[model samples]
Target: MSSAQSSMQLSNVSDPLRVHVPPNETPEERKRRIAAEKKAKKISEAIDKQLKAERDEMEKTRGTKLLLLGSSESGKTTVLKQLKIIHGKGLENEREQYRHIVHLNVLTAIKALAKGFEVNNLTLENSENDEHLAAILSLSSIKESLNRQSLSLQAAVGGLKSADDATAILLANYESVKAVWSDSAVQKYFESANDIGLQDSAKYFLDNVDRLAQENYLPTDEDILQARIRTLGVTEHKFDINSTTYKIYDVGGHRSQRQYWAPYFDDVNAIIFMAAVSAFDQPLEEDLRINRMRDSLDLFNTICNHPLFKNTSIILFLNKIDILKKKLNRLQLKTYFKEYQGANDFQSVTKFFRREFLSRNKVVDKNVYVHFTHATDTTQMRVIVASVNDMIQRENLKASGLI
Candidate 1:
């Protein structure tokens, strides 16, 4: 996976994924299938026995955390949904594939945590009781959570700017409450105040998530908690051949939650940075759309120097080419951009990426490959998954001293 050839692979003429050997009797079809079986066997040997340790190390140490960072509604969720289909099943059932597709619902997690706040924030018209104090604290805590740039989560509740200030200024600022606890009692009571509202709405939120998780039946608290636990392990994907399962840490792309992005690099053995070609054309300064690309570059720069990812085999996916397929020219994207600050030319965008995100011809950059992918189309989707699996195969080969 550490070679530029890591991104290249043999694929069938009819398909960008599979290939088969020429059959002695059959002209095309049987020939292809036979070749496929042989290729699958070779790839499998390369993966299971040769590169098993590297892949296993990925399982054990650094989960090549596939960070799908893009602003909300930028089709990041759609990308994830598409991946689940590939992983849940298989592109074409290749015997050698090792990539595990996992999806993290960061927005859903934020919404659930927010619901706890919304429930707490609703102060009743006639309530001044002790129970209400808890609600107020909950409200304050939630507000803080909503306002956070990201949640590494030090103390969810406890810090006070001085007990006297907690009632006023500190409580009002979401950041202040975030500093302490988003689950504090006093914060909930205030947030639940009839004036602030949302107590009734929280029930609906919980009910929906629970029902969905339970396969259309309402789930017990245990099920919801288990689901939550699953969401936290994906900072970067960790793998091990020693075990059947590996851990992955997924990164978030929300503008307000970007702060949580960098900390995950500490543990990753490999990195998959997802980007959109849209940024090259329709770059924007303020919009959420462009912020994803900008943030990816920002976060990648953070990972590049970080001890964990510096030499790690990193894959850069130019996701959502389906949208770009319709693109006409650089000039068309001018409207998408707020203003052409420096890169008014098409070459400038390329220059911008070179100066910013790329590692400037490091050995890692050579191994660091870019794969253009459209996750929705079955054909293209196969290509993308195969590309990643191929990278893993090469790594396995190198580990076994075969290449």
Candidate 2:
């Protein structure tokens, strides 16, 4: 191992970070800390003075929260990135605030974790050929990305969402330097849903993020790294979501991860259910989209039926339609809602899901509808995302008599 790794293993801050104290200070120097604290407090107030206090109450997200819950890789994070660009400056503080409240602390722990790691780390299952790169994410690393929070775009879905789910997903994948990873030993040895300890670790990690920032050692580099990515990888531009600003909660679509979706429903206000077009019939190796959709839909049924989410507004996004550009037809999609255009191809597959899955329980009381697009190909995904956003906003309006 490199010196860095060796130093890191020994560097775990088992206790809280140390206070920055000057060397060989006399009793009189203790007052220096008081002065310093006052000065720092003044600086913070001055910087924030430019921003208005009723910021949250001024625009769309103030009253309503939107959650992006769907199968993994459904482009929820990408959509939030799009919103950051569209609402730039206007929602800059909101985005930063969300990141601050959500992702700050464990970022420190992740740094500590990565410090102990060496490049080219890998683990074997049965043989060297079966080995793979070490998993980088940990429950502790998720920080504020989980936990209960007030609301944002994700609130539009249901209360189950915490921060922007989509944003958190991409943040986890950002440059190795910007974000930290779980030590290979920890990831391989202890990370699992069944590992009840992870739940506590997740809670503890969030508490630190909240506590550290409250003490003003916040807006750290990793926090800024997440903020810098606020507008990263988004494709939507014309989508006029509620007041043109949104906080989207993204959900994992994998079978193993689906169970995590339930706890987020308590506070969400809106929902975007993503269905990937390209994932429909692809083999598992080709993509997990198909299974993710089926699993997600089943989960959606669970969410909608939940007493708290029964009245929530939900918009269904048919993500990844670009992959089917050569194969798709509007007329064909219309057939999905019809009795028989020979329910085949994309329409048939989706129709079967809707009819079987959504109709089975039938508890959803708020507006619910499906639209299609490819999340990656902006040309098509743009329309789908926009349509979903607009539709959900309209539902909110109709319910509130705002329109």
TM-score for each predicted model, relative to the true structure:
0.40, 0.41
Per-residue lDDT over 344-378 for candidate 1, one digit per residue giving the tens place of the 0 to 100 score: 45456444444555653344443666666664455
Q: lDDT value for candidate 1?
A: 0.42
Which runs of model 1 end up more than 4 angstroms from their true locations? Answer: 1-76, 89-246, 279-292, 327-331, 334-366, 396-402
Q: Which numbered prediction scores highest in TM-score against the true structure?
A: 2
Name model 2 segments beyond 4 Å from true.
1-63, 85-245, 255-263, 282-290, 324-343, 346-357, 401-403
lDDT of 2 at 115: 28
Q: At residue 209, give the lDDT of candidate 1.
A: 34
On residues 191-272, what C-alpha lDDT tens digit does candidate 2 reach at each position? Answer: 3211111211232443344343342333432233222221112222223444555545455444445566666666666777
